[model samples]
Target: MNLLDHIASVAALAGRPWHDHAALAADEHLRFEWYRDAVPRDEIAFLRLVLADPDREMAISAVLARIDERARSSIDFHSWADRVEPVCAPVEFLSRRLAEWRLLIDAFAGRPVEDAAVLAASDWAQRKLAAVVDGDLLVLLAEHGRTRRVRALTRVPRPARPVRLSDRAVTSGPIRPCYG
Candidate 1:
């Protein structure tokens, strides 16, 4: 599937809505123009609702659980990353990180976690991702959880991929002809 469809599928899984083409493009300049052009306006509005709210981490997780359920009832997450460019990394990262944050918040708020439970959670949260899109998302999420206070959760930065030369588009440049 194409990127938008992939994102929609994942969002469908995560139960989070995405932004409309105009709104998404408004927020992020690089959305595929042709794809954006084709999406319906109401869908875009629904997408806007998903993108607009930052307080919906729990809701997003619920959506992801649904997506996971669908996958389990059928197939594995094949091409999971490519299917949801940018969105997958962010959602995956956010979901794991939010869960980690919940633990930390519990700890700080004096809620107790069994030592084994904390270790297991940390291990799961800090595992390195293998896919290109999911690369290090889990680790970063864990790190984010470790570094911040619960009250500062809203201020956490979104996941970012490292710049790779291979991912760049090539453009022509002026060149002089070589002498024979």
Candidate 2:
């Protein structure tokens, strides 16, 4: 899917030149496609997932790690997608995309490959995702309601374990369902 390709593209940037603070206006290093499409969809879908199964944290983190592995792999996206398409039935692909977004954000924040902070970031990310879904109303306020936004962000619990993103996690390992 386009989201996967975008993740691969952004993940590849881990090896590219870094830009100055003045150069990044929105604090987002990802492509415009991510902002236009994936971000909201990701939040909504993930919120729905959390609402459905709040206890699936371990499984979600594991799947997200696998996704980060895939995005960071050297293999072509379509080729890998084709191979795993069969194994990833129903909602597997969707979850994989969400995982990609999360890891991509982390990598840009200097948490690439493997970072201990990411271990703790997972919890925060989860809480943040849940808050956005639960507090969608606050988002309608002017300027996205700065006070409300901070409240939402501050309330998010930090991650217990950061999702792992290895250099060759996918290409060197057995391909399997990256369900989140």
All candidates: CA RMSD in angstroms?
19.6, 23.2
In candidate 2, which residue ranges exceed 4 Å CA deviation? Answer: 1-56, 92-180
1-180 per-residue lDDT for model 1 (tens digits): 444464465345344455453454343322333222333333333333343333345335433443344334433333332233344345565445445544444444455544444444543332311111122332343444343432133244546778686786765885458899
Tens-digit lDDT string for candidate 2 (96-172): 46444454454443443233332333443433433443222223222233344444564555455565666435676
* Displacement of the residue 90 alpha carbon in candidate 1, Å: 2.6
Candidate models: Cα lDDT each: 0.40, 0.39
